[model samples]
Target: MAEPTISVIIPAYNAAAFIAEALLSVLNQTSPADEVIVVNDGSTDNTRQVAASFEPHFGGRLIIIDQANAGVAAARNAAYRRASGELVAMLDADDYYLPAFLATARRAFTLMPDIVLFFGDTEIVDANGPTGRLNSEGKPVRTLPAIEIDGLFKVRGSTFTTLLEGSYIPVCAAAVRRATALAVGLFDLSVRTSEDRDFFCRLALRGPMAFSREVMAHERIHGGNISISTHRVDLARNVLTVMRKLRRPEHACLMSDQERSALEAVYKDEFFNYVYNLSSAGWRAYVKGVAMLPADERLAALHPKHLARALAAAVGMSSND
Candidate 1:
């Protein structure tokens, strides 16, 4: 069999309700993926069965690998090892891609062969309504200009700083060259969350990344999502782990005073937010972060916007009481 131009890897765990839609979205792509590998990470539900249903439709083009219960990072790494394509794309089992995702990615890669990674805007949908927007903070939400290598460094720090502060790019909306991903050593399985952020930061250090204006991915926000249900303590711990990793020698030269300050502020906010979410010992973590901040900048983290949100949350809690 010939190698495919693009390999889509979907890591699924107990995603029976949405895995079928996710697979269909890929199969319906105008420029269908040459290979689609779905990694079943010891799902307790019918995730494997749902993935198997697509094999008859996609035939040899679809591949399924069952593994012990591992985190998404480990699952993704396992899938990447098995993929044989120039371009590697990721689609979470619960997220569906737009029909134009692969076609747009192919065109973008062809136009800018030097780009190591490419990502598009994403739409957020929930049971209540559609957010109808991409994160406005990182990599401007409007139409992206054709950027070159020189342009990358000019905005890399600011863009990455914003993304690290909060997850701006949906995991399902990203695609990277296989070689670049391998060169970067794939995702880190040590951290439970923020693995994608760490992976992108490492990749950004290697080569230029292109952005597409169109929202080629749909992110479903549901009660079951880790982002929504996971305890803030766990989230904060993983975020801190990611931050500590960034301070290593490989990324040391890239860190500027402003970038470091931004990172510190983000940690402070996370600590406070964890407290607001009622996580145990969050206050202690917040105090520790505050103590670490430079005296002059400690107050900067208590910006009016954050203060207001914290106050609002307090009021809501009081009302519930």
Candidate 2:
């Protein structure tokens, strides 16, 4: 097997409907990936058949692995373990990359030899069409010392706090050195949701991150999105887990003061989500969250307001009151 300089790892579930487009996007890259590995996570659909169809076209460059019904984190880890490329790019089976993605990655690496991870801008599209740039609750992504080339803003490093504000880097839009990913221990398998937050935070700690302002990836928003399909309460709980994980002693030093503030803000947002989003149900989840989180003045200060809102909501009192 010829060693691939860049290995694309794709974790597919029952994504037979879209895996072909995803694989074709990779194959059509302006700078092609040396290898593409697809981990089929026990998809009942014909996902394997679709992925295998491209093997001949890729001429031995496409590799497929079959695994039990593991979550995305486990599937990614499985593909990572089998990947032999110096650089690893992650793509979900349902999402596809733009032709310039690999070219931008290669150029970014050439510009900054020490770049640990390079992520491009993403455009969110549904069955309709392009919506706009991905908007998270956090501040927009901007470079510290930005240089514009071919309409792409090049940044030397992306602030950890900026990332902690929200999920700025979509997995499909990001690429990392194989060694950097392994050193950071790959994705956290125990986490079922918000795993990207945990992984990206840890990755940012290892070295500098580069940003390509151009939208080089397309994020498909469908009802089947795991983060969207899951109940909000469950999503809130998983986000809390990520928050607590970031607060661990070993990871604490990795956060700057601003990053800590951003994390706290995210905690408050979670508090609102789990505590006040659905009144009684939210109250129950919020109580569990309170028990889970360590006592902090920041959280304490926001409790009464959230509690009042939850109670008011329970009593059918509108905010107009």
Q: What C-alpha root-mean-square deviation, in Å, does candidate 1 show against the real structure?
A: 6.5
TM-score of 2: 0.82
Highest lDDT against the true fold, candidate: 2
- Position 164, candidate 2: lDDT: 69
Candidate 1 residue lDDT tens string, 197-225: 88887776666677766688888887764
For model 1, the stretches where C-alpha displacement exceeds 4 angstroms are: 1-4, 128-158, 224-230, 254-321
The segments of candidate 2 whose C-alpha lies over 4 angstroms from its true place after superposition are 1-4, 128-139, 142-158, 224-230, 261-273, 277-321
Predicted structure 1, TM vs. truth:
0.74
The true-versus-predicted C-alpha distance at residue 168 of model 1, in Å, is 1.2
